[model samples]
Target: MARMIVAEMCPQCGSLDVRATEPGWFRIEWDRRDALDGGWVEHLEFGCRDCGMTWD
Candidate 1:
């Protein structure tokens, strides 16, 4: 199994005030064959209604 991580940031202004209008799940992949292959692989989806910005 792999662990996933997501961040809230504004793509336009690069602000941390980014909020999630829609919440969802993100799937991550891990490469057991490689030592440093296990990390953040995918992001679900999130949209900021404040600035009308969408990010993952």
Candidate 2:
């Protein structure tokens, strides 16, 4: 059997139909000369379409 991976889901409606507002991609800087050495991070403000629940 194949396993399914879900990235995000609505907590209120328990629905997979979710949208992100003001999504941003950021890199962690740790006082390093090379910024590439830091890891990449994602910031998302999710909102549920069904229940209109928003969260960071």
On TM-score, the leading prediction is 2
For each candidate, give its TM-score against the true structure.
Answer: 0.34, 0.50
The C-alpha RMSD in Å for every predicted model, in order, reads 8.9, 6.7
User: Which residue ranges in model 1 land beyond 4 Å of their true spot?
Assistant: 1-7, 21-43
Residue pairs in steric clash, candidate 1? none
Candidate 1 lDDT over residue span 22-46, tens digit each: 2443333444424443443334566
Model 2 whole-model lDDT (C-alpha atoms): 0.72
Q: Clashes in model 2: which pairs?
A: none
lDDT of 1: 0.57
**Model 2 stretches astray by more than 4 angstroms:** 1-5, 23-42
lDDT of 2 at 55: 90
- Summarize candidate 2's per-residue lDDT along 1-56 as a digit string, tens digits: 99998678987889887887656544444665256534443466999888889998
